[model samples]
Target: MRKLLVELGGTRAVAEMHDDIVPKTCDAVWRVLPVEGMAIHANWSSREIMLHLHGEKILRLPPEGPVRRGTTAPGDIVYFWRSPQMSRGKQLAYSSEFQRELSELAIFYGDPAGGGLAADDPARSGRDSNLQVSTLFATLIDIPREFARKCEDVRHTGLQRLLVTRLGQ
Candidate 1:
């Protein structure tokens, strides 16, 4: 398994890519190693931290095979791909119907008991179901409860320097 090290300020979190299940997505992320971006609390869910990459480059890869959708747990890393036409209108549109554009990665760090269908109900799927098909590519394998709590504490404060890099070089 491929491991990734995520540093939020002084704290650290480690995640393992599920290459066996999401080979395409894992390969895409591996190609873009050592990425730094802004980590912010997700407006849709308090359990999620949104990692906004610093570029117009949208991460996209062909579906490797049949995969589960919307099911996530604490430490799960997800990739939400934006559509190309998402910015061309009076309002932003999010849907699986449009061509893929940029990608937004989210790390879940909330109570598992508090997550379920409500965490991803259709009505809560992006701004008008645009995120009905986001991909789950990895899961935190060595994250501690303290680190998870730190992430939750900054859920509202916003992290300015979130760094993601492959472990051991």
Candidate 2:
């Protein structure tokens, strides 16, 4: 029943951890309280904002952690275990094969179902298999009507500041 307060731009949102369903994942996130990062628009997922924890190390997902599949609804918080990107030696070029290696905290602000991706639709595979393997940790709760609107504004305006912290902390 842990609660997280997420501040995006000037709007405030709340998320309730799914400890019952994803206990391990919730513990991992809880240990890293007050995760401050920049909210960037996701490239692979639609209507989702990815929290980029710059220079911060994150706990690795458990080997047998619970994995949630399919499209996420508005207010769903997903964790992406991004692999480290590799650079081509001596070529001074970055390879797309290993691009976007930082772990991401994704916050969905729109309904995936409305976007033609059903919750149980098997055809909704992500851009890569890695995305499909991301974990669902929590869901936003008691969100204000303006929360999604502000997220949309931030998505279009540029990267915005986001703070994820526990209720008492």
Candidate 3:
């Protein structure tokens, strides 16, 4: 059985797929939508928003409601980036460094899709921001814990290769 750990609003939850699984007060069981690239999973009953991190399905309070795709509902929901603040002190879980890396990746590459980095010049382009985000998300959200750590190592090396190629002697 594969289990992933997730941090939601400072609370911890473990997402696992198996029979007779235990649910924590802040945790819920969910069937991850593999096609969405490890995004949020819609609540089975309430249509609330929940994120799949490290195999753990985390549901923050005050559910974000259903996600509608045009007229058809996709049966998933998440807090819009533009939505009002979530809690009195709670901030979105994004980091400035991460965003900076993502922006660089978007401009230099194209977008952060497919979770891999492709450069016109192996010696010029390095770990773009989008790739970092993709790697982070792919590692932290999709894979199991042990594999996730390996992914992090891969991410580090990939970025270093880019950096060295770009600024080497």
Candidate 4:
């Protein structure tokens, strides 16, 4: 399986792509290797942090694999895209580019991820369409304690540098 090294606040974790289950999604993500940016914590999705994509790095792809209402697990990495701000709340922390077209690499770091809308926005849960799509592309093989702590720190301390690079590259 293809793997990636996810780094945040000087700590690191390893994730293996779900290439066998979602080949197209995996391929698309793999092509855009070494994604680096300031990761902001998720407001709706508990225990999650997001790395927003901008400019040419933004990937606009259709959803792949089965649609899951809930059942989001810890260490799951998702390729998420949402058109504009259709939801009730505003994404104030995101960049201006994302305000128009939001593209994100979502990392599930800790508790509250295994079930419910902690992996999704409640307002937009059942409404799956081109307007919004989230594809589970990878799963972290090992979530280091320090890495998890740094991800949690984003909630209090604000945005932190997050990098995702192809393993063995």
TM-scores, all candidates, are 0.75, 0.75, 0.19, 0.90
Q: Residue 33 CA error for candidate 3 (Å)?
A: 2.6
What does candidate 4's lDDT look like per residue over 1-169, in tens digits?
9999999989999999998889999999999887999999887788889998887888998989989676678899999887765544675777666646778899999988735453445656655555787899999997899999999999999999999999985
- lDDT (tens digit, per residue) of candidate 3 on 1-169: 3344443222232333222322221133233322112122121212122222222222222222232222211211122111122112322443222221111111011112222212122322345322211111111223234433322333333221111001110
Taken over the whole model, the C-alpha lDDT of each candidate is 0.67, 0.67, 0.23, 0.85
* Superposed model 1: Cα runs more than 4 Å off: 84-102, 112-133
What are the root-mean-square deviations of the candidates from the true structure over C-alphas?
Answer: 5.5, 5.5, 20.2, 2.2
Clashes of each: 3, 0, 6, 0
TM-score: the better of candidates 3 and 4: 4
Candidate 4 pairs with clashing backbones: none
Superior candidate under TM-score, 2 versus 3: 2
Candidate 3, pairs of clashing residues:
4-54, 15-55, 15-56, 101-129, 102-129, 105-129
Model 4 misplacement above 4 A: 85-90, 114-128
Cα lDDT, model 3, residue 32: 32
Candidate 3 residue 89 Cα shift, in angstroms, is: 11
